[model samples]
Target: MSWITQKLPDVLFIQEGPGIRKYEYEENGYPMINVRCVQDGYIDMSSARCASMELATTKWKHFQVDEGDILYTISGTIGRSAIVKEADLPLLMNTSVVRFKSLTPDLDPKFVYYYFKTDLFIDELLGHSTGTAIKNVGPSHLKKMDISYPSLEEQKRIVAILDQAFTHIDKARALTEQNLRNVRELFESYLQQVFSLIGDRYVEEALDDACELITCGVAATPKYVDESEGVPFLSAQNVKSGKVVLDKYRHISKDLHAKLTKKNMPKKGDILYSRVGAGFGEAAVVEHEFEFSVYVSLTLIQPIEAKLDSYYLKYLLNSPQIKSLARSSITSSGVPNLNVKSVRKFLITYPALQKQKSVVRSIELMESEIGNLESIYQNKLLELDTLKKSLLQKAFSGELTKNMGEAAA
Candidate 1:
């Protein structure tokens, strides 16, 4: 009962603007921050902007969010929070926005920041949210908010523990992220080394001499009755993020698949590259067993696995140089297209089958290590996030005090 009203310091609602909902704006409306600017877990100033600067002096002057302010989205994308990094820039507070600033020296700002990130606070915020489609929360709701923390020393201790813990976790995660990037760069570099073009210094060999075959799919608008009756129409859309996203996979009738060119069904090992639309030339190997009903806008590039490795070649096609060259060859303005003929012109070095296998083996090894590091840190971060949530729950509910002496020490 006593904890319910601990007489904690005041936490104000984000500063509200003078303008009401659906209000008409003048030439320079209030310069409120955009919702999109406050991205998940961070503030993206890249797209952050003010509504307009013109407002009455009394309203306009106080709207500016200062440095060291903690901002949270009180409207759209509820619970999205981040600390304002750029203190110099004067950004008008957006609607349903709130800030927590001017903390006493006894309180730790980092503790305050972490405290706001807990499920307890989120539940408290969510409990107050009103409206079905779009939850609207304003100043009155924030002033009534409550949170509990230990004494100043405990607060500093909690922040210190979190700081050391997150620092270690973050360093590991950062290294893994960097390693993945390095592997990608290494693969790209290998591609360039294979296909060097200079002032008539490098040899330009025909792609056919290097690759086994380049096959094009059929132009068929396959019919779709039901997922129970038809096979999935594997289009370029399925080739997303370097893998097939089967959730939105389309289906085509059996009759349509029969009428469509036999080449429409790509066999395993064939590299499928999107040949039409905005995502042209993005390729992925057909690794899974699926009925492929492809469009003519797509092409299949394959190499005799004995003579050339498809993964290595797929890496080559995705390289920046090759992609730029392919983009330049597109003729249609409305829908950019790259045919099999144009793809045959793609230059690459044919470093004997043995060396090709060696390159593949080396990349595979590095990729495996990078994958492990990424998975490890990814799992660790998830655990830390969950721990943060659990700790926040305990801290607010009084359970956090059991270990308070040890943690504080």
Candidate 2:
């Protein structure tokens, strides 16, 4: 039979219960699990929730995950999943998730999880997934997917190899993540001190005092063309937890690019803040000369190089407190929006150039250390993935050893 017709057991899962209440609500059904919890290979319990048992029982009973069950997302992130550890067997999953376990032991659950995580799997998943907003594929669609594997013992061997390798990857990633978090905390602490150190000596100045440019994208959505048009666009999506994610982005036409440059062209180090919706105050420092695609969702802050330190101001705006204030300061619009006139009123204490340089350098050092750790972790992660794919190829090709039995454990 052609590899396309191969069969294996297919299962489904879902997100259950509200992770958190983003808006007002009364009847508490099961808290919905969100994409946030599924990042990396683990479900971040930090944001999960419990809802009314009776309601949850009725609404989310469709997709129940058990211990060792592998849960994959059905929408948005398409094919992203996590192994249900021993602790979370009873928890209900939601509509966007699916649980799968192969009927044939030749398909190791761990192997499946790793396979789904690969660049190859992602490509196939995206190709099969439906929708323009967020990708999605139903359980039936998943069951129909052609997958081939090896003998049960061979599958176990591959899973064993992967588990050992990824444990190291996981630890390295954990350390890097910790370092990143620590740097963020350090920045916050030092910023507080900086703001207070210059408190009494502060100058009350207009935002333009430190400005080379301050504006937002056109409020109107003009004509848009695909990447063929040779225009690139940046949106709130580019700003992910204060970092720019250029991998998945949109493009526009050459004509539209010309029009936007006539408006506001982003330069390296300019602070880009979200101007619309729930992401109203989020910001990312521009790191490249990419063309701006969607403007209505952002506010650009270009600081005066001589008078204002753009890096310092960018960090200030990225602070959680400032973002909270910016979100609250949104005016009445269809959705909340951070207007240039209203938001620029945000004030920061100015210190002497030397002090400013000192703080910026400190933050820069912290960022570098964190960046190094992040690189190690990311590389380890890639290595683990490569090992997994190799193991899969071996197992299916009948080269993996099945002798890791009671003796190897």
Best by TM-score, which number?
1
Candidate number of the best lDDT: 1
lDDT for residue 331 in candidate 1, whole number 0-100 = 73
Per-prediction TM-score:
0.64, 0.62
lDDT (Cα, tens digit) per residue for candidate 1, span 58-170: 54677677767777777866777777767435666666667777445655667777777777777787788999879878767766777676667777766666555556555
In model 1, the worst 10-residue window by lDDT is: 1-10
Clashes of 2: 18
Cα-based lDDT at residue 24, candidate 1: 36
lDDT of 2 by residue, 1-409 (tens): 1122254343223223233333422244444455556665777655655555664566545545567777777678776678878765456665566667566544567867866766655676677788999887766566556565555565566677657655665676577667656756775676565555554554556676667777877677666667776676777766766676788766667777777777567778888878777767776777877566556777788887777677777666776557667877778667787888877777656676676777678767866776676676567667655665665455444555545222222
* TM-score computed on alpha carbons, candidate 1: 0.64
| Over 4 Å off, model 1 | 5-11, 14-32, 39-42, 55-63, 74-78, 85-88, 95-112, 123-172, 183-226, 234-263, 274-282, 294-309, 319-345, 351-366, 380-394, 397-409
- Listed per candidate, the RMSD to the true structure in angstroms reads 6.6, 6.8
Instruction: Evaluate residue 13 in candidate 1 and report its C-alpha lDDT on the 0 to 100 scale.
Output: 32
Show model 2 residue runs off by greater than 4 Å: 1-6, 9-70, 82-97, 101-165, 187-202, 206-215, 225-234, 237-271, 277-294, 302-312, 315-342, 352-377, 384-397, 401-409
